[model samples]
Each structure stands twice: as C-alpha cells, then as structure tokens.
Target: MILPAPIPDRVDVVIFGGGVAGLWTRWRLEHAGYSTLLLESSSLGHGQTIASQGILHRGTKYAFGKDVSQASMELLMAQEVWSRAIKGVDGPDLRRVTVLSPTTVMWTSESFLSRFTGAVAAGVLKSDVKKLEGDARPAAFKSAPKAVNVWEIDEKVVDSSTLVRELARVVRGPMASLAPDAHTHWDLPGMLSWTDAAGRSHATHASAAVLCAGVGNESLITSLAGTTSVPGAAASHVSQRRPLHMVMMRGAPCDLFGHCIRELSDKPRLTVTSARDADSFVWYLGGSLAEDGVSRDESTQIDAAKLAVHECLPWVDVSRASWATLRVDRAEGRTATGKRPDTPIVSHIAAAGHTLAVWPTKLALAPAAAGRVFDLLETAGIRPTGVIDAGEPALSPAPLPWNEGGVRWR
Candidate 1:
C-alpha cells in the first residue's frame, strides 16, 4: 500500500477515476511532464476494469456479420496500438504486464449458419487468423467432434488487475482515495474538494479536471452539465450504460481463452477467458451470454451459463465446477442509436474553466483516450507546468472479481 501523502493543492490535471482509462491518462500526463492527481472513490478498477474479460479485440469478431462494421475497424486500430505498446513500442511499455494468452481461439459449431459466419469472418480477417485441424489443434479442442471448426486469432488476453497496478506504478504521482461517504465538489478550471478519512476536507486545483469514472461519470457529468453556461454543453456529450450479466465458473475443466461463434449475430456467442483463482483457475464468460443474460436473475443466469458451457464445449467435463454471476455496465458515450461508440470520446465542458468528460468506450482504446485529452490540452494552449511532488503512491489497485471474497458460488 502507498503511504499517505499531503494532497497537493494544485496540479496540471485532476483525474476522477482510477480505472484503465483514468490511470492510463494519468500515466501519459505524468510522462509528458505534467503534474497530476488521481482520485478514486474505491479501489482501482473495482467495477468495470477488473470485471473485464481482458480480450484485446482485433475486430475479427466483428466480421462475423455480412460486412465489417465501423466498430470493427476502430477496434482493429486499437488492437494495433495496444499490440505495439505491449512490445514496448509506440506507446506505454506494457512488457511487465502479465499476458494470460498470446492468442485466442475462435470455434464454430456444427450449425450451418455458425459455419458460414466463421467462413466469412475468416475471409475478412484472413491475415489475423489461421485454421487448425487434427494434430495442429490446441489441447483444449483435442476431443472436439469432426464437425467443429477452430481457428487461432491474433488477440492478446491480459490480466486487467496487473495492468491497473502497472499503470499506477508508473504514474509517479499522488493518487487519493475518497472516503465512501465523501462527496466531491467541483469548481471552475480544476478545483476539486473532498472529505478524507478523518473527516478532514481537502481541496485541490489544476489546469484541467477529467471525469474518467465509468458509471459514476453519469452523475458527475450531470452535475457539471447543470452548471455549465456554454451552449449545448449538456447535450454535447452524454453517458450510457449497457448492462451485462457475466458468468464465472470455478474449477473449470481446462484453461481456455476463446469465443464460440454462432449464426444470426455479429457478436460472439460466448467469449471465455481463463484466470487463476488461488490454487485453481476460473473461467469468466461474456459476449452474447452476458448480453442476453442481462434479463436473467442470478439462478437463471447460472443455469443458462451451465447449459451454454455444456453445449459449446461438449468435449470438456465440468461436473465439479461451481458458478457465480457478476452484473456490470459497459459505460460509454451515448450514440445516436444507442450503439457502441467507434472510438474514445473526450468532451470539453468548458464550464467557466477547462473541465472535460472522457470515456474510452473499450479497455483497448485507453491510450487513444489519453491522446484525445492531449490534443485538447494542446489546442487549448495548456502547457506542462512543474510536477507536483506527491511524495509516495497513495492508491492501490483493486482486487480482481475472482479474488474478491463473499462470492456465493453454486
């Protein structure tokens, strides 16, 4: 844990979230010689980041439809940016972050539509995937029936918790944690006030204040928008939440990271990622299962997930597995049709001062979010001021979902 330090009264930027996007933006700002202070109401990545399946999507999954959509192309660019960063080029050096899988497998069921979608996706993403058959197949599919088709796609899975810690470590500034009951009051141009553990209130000022809190951004944006005098500032950007009922299974049959593709949908049927849970491993399930499962209660979702696992991977035995469910919201900038935004969005509130609302949309596009903030800062003529000596790190990374206690698995 980072020892407490006296919160600086001023800095270059005051970021309001400690998730991937917030922490990443902090790292970028500090590296560019700007002083930053990050404030989190809870442990880092508590809701969205840690719950993410950590798939660095390459837009291949988006090609299962009739044609590649704009979201697919945006993710393709994000994939390239992240891949380069992972290799210690172009962006932040993520070599120290743990990679759960270098590549992910995409498998098609015996259904004709599933096979057809898989074939079309292969053609569209030819350079990113390669077919595997017989002895070339990974052990996870060794027992697969002849009708099943599997291909390895170039996508990297990461330990989101580790990435959060790494980003915090490199930020080289103070990160403050607000008391659970503490409320933040924002002022023009970068002033933030909050109560501390001892009931002491502290306030800091910066050149810019960025709202990076995921769902929390909703209320914060509402508050800021309510006070802004700029025309259409309230409507300039809005936040939306797309809820997901993700399933988790402990004591999974095997370590597998892949997506099960089916017909009539552009999204993967089931996207599974493996992560260590103590001495054993757990499989975090997402994609269509999570999306469609949103309406399902806990028990119903678990039952549906069990059926999905059995149906998708008939070769694997999961009699001893226990299951649980996590309900999370995919927070992003609201689009015209309530669809996912194609890229990171940064909105300048300019409410009496430089206040901005930011949403990376996807975890892989965090760097792009930072880039957007940078462009805004540059365009506004905000230069790097002297760094604030925050003494020691002040915040800690949040626990992963599987590691968090009190989960009642069945």
Candidate 2:
C-alpha cells in the first residue's frame, strides 16, 4: 500500500490542477525559488494533456491562406519555445522525454487547387518547408500515386505522457490530490483556505492562488468566488468544448506521421501518427476525420476512418488491424463567435491579487501560458519566498491515456 504525505500549513503559491499548464507553471515558479504546492483532484495530465495528439505545431496549419492570424503568430512563438525545450539547450530539459517524430510530413494529390495550396503554404512557411523529390519520400508513400506532392515540415511530436512525467519530476514539492470537499476560499486579503479528505481543515496565507483546472476551472472558481465570471472582462469568462472522436488501429503496416491534403479544404483530410504498442505498432488518426467522427456512431466512425485510410493511404494494409475509438473534448476560453481561441487565456478577479485562472488554448502553448501566469503573479506583487524541499506530500502521476482505457475496440 500507499500513504498520503502530510500537508504543509503554508506556501508562497498554491496551484490547482496538474495538467501541462499547471505542471509547467509550477516547474517555472519552483525553479524561480517559490515555495509552491500543486493540488489536483485527480492524477496529473488526467484530461487535455494526455488526450492531445502531441503535435508541436508551427502555425503551418494556419498557413492555408495568404493572411496569417494572431493565432498563427502564437503558434510560431510556441514552436520556437518547444524546439528549445526539446533540444534541452535553452528552457526546461526535455531531451530526456520521448519524441515520436522529429519532423512531420505533408502531402496531397496532384491537382490545380492542391498545387496552389502547396505553393501558398510553401511561400508562407518559407524555410520551414522542404520539398521531397521522388525517392526522398517516406517508404509508406511508395504506393501513393505518382501525381502526389510531398513536403517535410519542422514540426515534432512528443509522447505527452513522458512530457508530463518530466515536468512532474522537476517540481520542488510533492503534488497532492484534493479532497472532494476541499473548498478553496480567498475573499480575504492574503489568505487561502481549504479542507482535506480526512475532514481536516487547512488554511494557508499564500501570496497567490492559480486555477489551471481546464474544464474543471468553472466549477472551482464558482465555488470560491460565488460566480463563474471574472471581473472587468467584456463578458463573463466562459469555456467552450470542441469534441473529437479519434480512431486507432493496432498492427499498423508501418511507422508514419503525415497529413493528407485535398484541393478544396484548408484542413487535412486525415492526420496519422504511429506509436509502438508492445511489439506491434498502432496508428492513431486525427485532424478533420476525428472532428467529423464526433457525430458518427462507433461502427460508422470506424468504417469512415477505414475508408479515409484506404483512400488517402493505399499503401496501409489494415486487413488484420484491430480498431478502437477515443472521444475527448478540447476545452478553451469561450470566444464571441464560439470558435477556438488563437492564444492562451489568463484572467483574474479585478484588483484581487489573491487568485487567477488560466487556460492554455493549445498544448504547444503551455510555456506561453506559464509566462502569462508569471506576469499575473508579478502584477499582483506576488514573489517567490524560497525553495521548498522535495520531500513533501506526493500525489500519484496520472496514468497514460492508453493505460486508462476508455476506448472500446471492435
């Protein structure tokens, strides 16, 4: 058996949630000498982080047209930040983490509109895109028609599970699992209080409290502030959920990561990633197919995915493949148009320095979210007191997405 660690009476900062945003913020704060504690109601990376496709996007997805939006710029910055982290030369040492692919491939069937899109993308991406000649293409595309056009991009894919573990290891103090009744209160100046699972009351005079609970943020804030809306915003802070139904196939024909492009659509027809499962390989499908699969029943979705694979990748032999579906939601700050936000969102109760809430719009933007949180803490006059020792209350890590298995394979 296992035992819970003794809770500390006080700390400089109390962070709620243990997803990428929370973990990255805690790591940054701790390294900056803050006495910090991370509280999670469940395991780390229990939601968005683990469900991510692990793509270190470089704004290439937004390069479909001539004008790049603000979201594209954020992605560009995120790409550079993640590149440094993965290399371990600048930011956190992510060199020890598992990288599924150092680069991703983009390809399309030869057509006038498709060629135009590729040209526009190439012009926008510039040096980020490298055209692949006849023999330079991946072997998986060997069966592809001769009219296919392919290019390589500087995007990378990392194992999200390993990424979270690495961040958790860098934290100074142990993370704790919050009790169901662990109500947080911060209306009073310079005070934070909550109850533990054993019905024990605990209060801390923390400099700041950060909520990085993603979809759980709304309820958490409402419980503490008596409202879900943050003060001084155009409107109440609301969250939107974008759902995805991803398809997975075991016994993949080969290892591959690439996007299948078509003439009319800006988004890819399919995005595929390969991962090792025991001795065999598994192919995970996402992008447009996953988005559309949300409305489809399991059998219909699997059939659609299989048809997509057959059409886009003639080389993939799925005759003996076992299929599964994983449905998840992408939570983010609500927009006026109810579309996805282009950047991370950080908001606090107006003039109330004691608490703040954050949503990393994309997994690639976690570092950027940390920077914003640091800024908020600074604006609130919150500063790191000192380093906390490693031996404090410890929380168990979140299980890997596949290990937790909500997937129903057919």
Candidate 3:
C-alpha cells in the first residue's frame, strides 16, 4: 500500500549487509516481483555466516528426541527454503560437502532426558516432526558412549561459502549491475549508505528501509533515536555465557556432516555447542548475554579452539587460521524465569519514519518480523510481500559476512 513516492528513477528496495538474511531477502523480494538492489560494504559473507559450522537447523535444535513446537515448525520450513535455494542456485563445487555423515547428540542428565522424552510422548514432538526416536544408539555414539537415546536424522550441511556464492549468482541476475550512483550515507556505513564500486546508492523512494546489518544494527541506534532495550539480558549473564570459538586447520577425524552437538555448561542454564564441518569444528558458546556483546577475549577464544580440537588432531596446522567473526546472538521477549528466549522481532525504531531492524540469522523467526515490517509499510500504502513469508526469515538487505578475503560465493 505504499503510496507512490515522488518520481524516482528506480524503486529498487535497498537492502544492507550481504549475509544469509540479506541474500535471502533479495531472493524473496525479486521472486515476488519487486525490483530490488543489494549493496555489500565489503563483498558478500566475509562475516559470521561463513564461519558457521554449516548445521542448517531443521527444527532439531533443542528437539533432540523431542517434538517440534511452533518454533521448530517455522525452523523446518526455513530449512526447506534453504534447501530449495541452495539446490536451485548452488554449483557442484559449492555444493560438494560431506553429505549425511552421522553424529550423536546427548544430554548428560537423565532428568532433562525425562522432560524431553515426556514432551515427545505427549505429542508435542509430533506436531511438526519429520521423525522422532529414543533409546536407540547411532553407530557414531554407540562405539563408546555414556549417554542414551541419541537421535539422528537426514539433514544437510552447507558449505556456506558456496551457498553464498550461488545465492549471489541467483539474486544478481543477468540484468543486475553495480548500482553506479553515489549512495547516500543515511547516517550509516554499509547498509543505509551502500554505494558499490560503481557508486550507485540505494533508492530512497521506497516505502521503508530494512536493516539487515546483524549486530551492527547498533549503528542505527542513532536512527532509532536512543539505545535499544534488552528485556532479559544483563552484564553478568552475558559474561558468564561468553564463549570462545575456534576453527582448526588440523582436519578432524569425525564425520560431522549434518551433525551438531551441544554440551550444557556446568554453570546452570549455560551451554556451548559444536558442529564439525568438512574443514573444522565450529564452537558456539551460549546462555549468556549474547545480545550485549561477548565478555571473553576474542583471540583467546581462537586459541581455545586450537587446544580443544588439538587433542583430537595433534598435527593440526595452527598457522593458517580459517575465517572468523565475532557476534552476540540477540534474543527477545524473555520468559519470566529467564531461559533462552524464543524467536525475536523488534518493531519500529520508535520515531524513525520508516525503518526496521533485525537479526537476520534468526530466519526461523523472521516471517513474523517481516509481516510486521510490511504491515508498517502497508500503513504508508506500500505492499511488498508478493512472495509471501513461507515461515522463512528472509526479511531485507545484504550483510557484511561476505568479503574479498574469500569470495563468499566461492
């Protein structure tokens, strides 16, 4: 319902950032018949997305042997979207990943298993479930394991770099070109003010601007007028949850394809997860103030990755460090008891005439966020959801994850 703006040369919907969310947004918008223009300050996907261990969550996050909830339902749908997008645009070299290499997921405590199992028995797990089994050991964890009822599934791993490259090819399309006009720096560096090497800026005539800048959205705190509000995150919790992540060039022996595991921390409610890719293992520490920024030393974290994985591979080459990026996972609308909050979307920058901010990786939760943003644009009479939100988090904009350091699309 966006009222037609003053005559502009192009109504290109400018998305900032070139990460998964930005690329996904471009795909969604273009497919929906919108003339979209994407701008990446660096290249594409030199940031957090490439550092991923490639465990495309198919709603199996906390649902090891349990049922899929509303969140899981949306996540499954997102996975399908990811699956289709990857299959459609990905090249053979890019898609050449260790497909279906098995792994195990375990919970140390039986009590937690009881709750998880109880949820499954009660049909909570079957709602959006593709499959659910318990008390069975996959050969991977069966060789010698201390846990029970390890569940495994047929999921996919993304060579994120390849995925990004294919996505870039698809979205850039034959006609898409470097936006050759000097972009207006709308009080920001990358997204709002993107002007590719050709110098073209974003179209200001759009009904609303979508901020896919990731944690860098802080750059828009000025646009939002003041600081953003964090409901349940605090300094102590964030520090306690501060994680150290590393990637070992040492070549792990484990078959990590389509496998992800989380080890709950000794500290109550804290956890760090790991997923092994063909190249290395990706370590993620959570249950702290992921939103307020990490309290741990970034370099030390990398060292820890070396040491932990070094135990598994003594000859690992510590010299060639693969790509790494620092990020604080933000959550929204925490429960009163304060566990990891489910699916988040913050609407309106209070006074900004027409802008929306989001954590793009939370694609499972983005359908809701996008609906809200589009609703706002609808108030201004602009309609852009022609492709519709198929429960995917493809909102709007390109990310900074891709860079020249590695052709993320490669």
TM-score of each: 0.94, 0.91, 0.58
lDDT of 3 by residue, 373-410 (tens): 44555575555533212222222222323222432110
Q: Which candidate comes out best when scored by TM-score?
A: 1
Model 1's TM-score against the true structure: 0.94
C-alpha lDDT of all candidate models, in order: 0.82, 0.78, 0.41
Q: Give the winner by TM-score: 1 or 3.
A: 1
Question: Candidate 3, overall lDDT?
Answer: 0.41
Tens digit of lDDT per residue, candidate 1, span 1-410?
65787788888888888999998888778778888888888888877998999988887787766546776777888888888777888567787889999999999887787888788778877898999899877677889898888999988999998888777776578888777656667765657788876678899887888889998877676666676565655633677778999999999756889999888577888899998766767999998899999999999999999888877887788889999999899888878778778788887766637777888988988888888898888788778886666665677777778777877889
* Minimal lDDT window, size 10, model 1: 228-237
Ranking by TM-score: 1, 2, 3
lDDT (10s digit) by residue, model 2, range 1-410: 33555556678888899989998888778877888778888777887887787888887876774345787889889889888887887777788789999888888755677767777676767778898877788867777776677889888988888898787776557566777657777753466777665567767677788888887876676675453354543224556678889888888867788888765455788898878888777888898899989999889999999998887776657799889888888878778887778899887744345777788989999999999988877777777888677553366556655556566667
Compare candidates 1 and 3 on lDDT and give the better one. 1
- Alpha-carbon runs more than 4 Å astray in model 1: 66-69, 226-237, 389-392
Candidate 3 all-Cα RMSD: 9.5
Best by lDDT: 1
Q: List the candidate 2 regions with Cα displacement exceeding 4 Å.
A: 1-5, 65-67, 110-112, 180-182, 188-190, 195-201, 225-236, 351-353
